[model samples]
Target: MFSPFDSILAFKTAIYFFLRSLLKGFLRRATGLCELQRLCYANNIGAKRTKGVEKSILLSRCPVLKRINTQLDALAEADELANNWSTVEEAVEATMVAKQINKSIHEAFIQPYRICLVQIYGYRQLIVRLDQIRGIAFDHNNEVHLVLLKNLWKLLCPDTELEGMISKQWTDIGFQGQDPSTDFRGMGLLSLENLVFFATVYTDHARNILSHSLHPIHGYPFAAVGINITHMALSLIKAGYLKTHLYNVESRIYTVEDFHKIYSYLFASFDKLWIRSKPNSVMEFSHIRDKFEAAVVKKLQFEDAVFRWDPYLETI
Candidate 1:
């Protein structure tokens, strides 16, 4: 067993194994490079070349990286999963998933990056669109935005006497100065829209929270914090971090409602967070906001994360 011939053979076998391993790894890297090239060329000749099962797999998975591929496979079955066109909430809908199978396989199955590219484009466009709206300089002459602002004020201050847009009554809801317009400089009409949507759609919850904002000892500026939260959500979406919450939905599924839902989640959750933090005064808002954002980020890291608002107090 200890013969020179046996020892020489063992050494040779070990060397051969190491060389084969290196060769295999090199081949794998080469194959991955080719795949990346195909992905880059996905809209062109690569689309025509990829066919049948391979094509389907590539469409569903996109093969961007090994890790993502593995994660997608484990998270969902390809056939059961909805195509990118379906909304995130709709994708998980059983009826929609069934209908998806009826659509042409060719159309239903396309590279996810195409969807991502569209959403990224749309996101930039939305930013520009909102920015333009913001640039409109809060015309007191305009009936639409001003009317909406008045409606929001009226809804919150039903019993109070009306004093128009310049009233100190505006401060009760958290506007920075006499004019609510000044506070909306950063978010424009978008902030106002979010506030109106929150108050109108969730009237009871909004009223309850407004009362909380008037808490004798501990309170933050309700409308001001709402706008800041909108900025926080926009930052998350722009950075592509919202992808976690929208994972089950299609990549192209950005909407104003989506943003509003985030606002609601932030509003409701921040209330709970604020109460729990038990700050001695409103001056601690920055610290609490940072902590709240950190918590939201933690939740977004989960694969199954969904933005939700669970209002603890009943509508007043």
Candidate 2:
């Protein structure tokens, strides 16, 4: 016969996992899980809650919780009954834990730079730098203007023909080199995304390299939403730019996932920013395109005139 103490202990333990599972699952979804596997997605986010909340989570799992994670482990153990038994218990025990831990196994191995946390300084200076970059890069004439801005417009303002604004801007700016689109695209010299990207890089590098002497963009609510390096890199690729600068050699492991995040954020999330402007079918909205291009050019022109564009550097 089972002793009363042993039976009581098992009952309490079961009740504990049961309530813990329910609370974790419910709480995680409410916090923006997008989608969660209901059967076994108590994202291991470590939490400290009262036992009463814990017990309720456990009591509801009579037929469900204990067996939820067993089959996968059991199948892999095929015929090794001894191993399968141990695996099943381990799986069940793990389910009692949450997915989002205060500390994670990856903690020991990965050192992630939460991109959102970094500080950006000096907007006027950043604008000056962007302008310097622009004066050199875009000061050329070609159908290339039409192409580069068109692609960027498609991303920044889809469903519109930005060719006119591109033409007007190039002419007004007195473009002098090879049109950036035809000469430096695909091979990665001066794509539109390059502006936002290299600005971050050069500014940071300049600040680091030169210490406080270098000025950074200030007072612009510049921010990156998530630690999605993959998304950033793909943004580079999708915008027809190069993926050279997103990471060091150590980050090669998470590169694919990072790219996916970049693709999702650009094409899927802020992509709508591309088409968010009010449409003026009757009135040529090309001027709005001009304003946007000018904003970009303004950013470029506002910076130091020294950072001239040389399409050749893109290839090298």
Candidate 3:
């Protein structure tokens, strides 16, 4: 049961919302604030009375702003007879002001401490591309549910920097809010281990969308490797640890050291990550990891040299 205060606040919220809608739609009216105050009073929401417990009874009798305007036409016309006249401008101003106030009231009723959800999605591409591969492909719009994943990616990575990296990479792939289970409640979202998952799971459409999501600009065939290495690097950075790795291109492995010198001025930020898959991301990482497990593995070790030696890596 809501208190009278709650009812008034809800009414205020609705009125203000209507105002915002009117503004967006460029709609106008011929009403004013006192009329709104009257509407509240008539709905048993104002200074005089209180004691409505039935939602159906209480809400059914309440007048909507639109209806109120229609009902007040005769009274407003009478007012025009008494005064000079009026236009829709007064009504619009009243509604808009009410809307802003209602927004404030609504905000006041909300709980503090806004929360952020970190959602992670599994392999869709690897699943689609390899029709033979077996794995889960989340197809539902709201399939993934995440309250918090990995402490908002806290560690060596600055909160903001980690946030940027997460947003740039995984955040966009995430599908949140869907309950994954058939049960009454609970979201269906889950994560697959990077490259392996990508190579073995994901629907064809999921695969395409996942690829596009990762590299909306340039489709890095090796994006998976880059993602894994980046996550590994960020993890290490958070733990005050480090790693060394390589960058891959077209099945060729080049030491980060080589590119460090060539793109030293540019790829310096990734100095800690080793840029080796030498593919780019999880998909690339999956392939490179299998083909070159003998060579790559966890060789991408990091140390103080990762940042002290290369400034850009520190930003990542």
lDDT winner between candidates 1 and 3: 1
Write model 1 residue lDDT over 1-316, tens digit each, in one string. Answer: 3899999999998897677557645854775422322333443322122221233333332233333334333323332222433432332232223323222433333343334333433344444444554455566889998888988887777788768779887888987778889888887787888888888887778888888887878887889988888788777766756755654343552456667777777787888788788788999999999998898888776656676545554221
Which residue pairs clash within candidate 1?
Answer: 88-249
Candidate number of the best TM-score: 1
Q: Model 2 misses residue 290 by how many Å?
A: 28
Tens-place lDDT digits, model 2, residues 1-316: 8899999999998887777777767865786331122221332111111112222333444343335324432342242333334443443344334333233432321112111000001111222233333344433454664454444334432344545543533322112222434333332322344423322333332122222111132111011111122234333333422222222111222222333233333322221222354343313234443444344333333212111222224211
Sorted by TM-score (best first), the order is 1, 2, 3
How far in Å is the alpha carbon of 42 misplaced in model 3? 93
Q: To one decimal, what is the Cα RMSD in angstroms of model 1 from the true structure?
A: 13.7
Q: Model 2, stretches more than 4 Å misplaced?
A: 1-136, 166-191, 195-316
Rank candidates, lDDT, best first. Answer: 1, 2, 3
Cα lDDT over the full model 1: 0.62
lDDT of 3: 0.29
Best by lDDT: 1
Each model's lDDT: 0.62, 0.31, 0.29
Candidate 2 is scored at a TM of 0.18
- Tell me the TM-score of model 1: 0.63
Candidate 1 ranges with C-alpha deviation above 4 Å: 1-108, 111-125, 250-253, 310-316
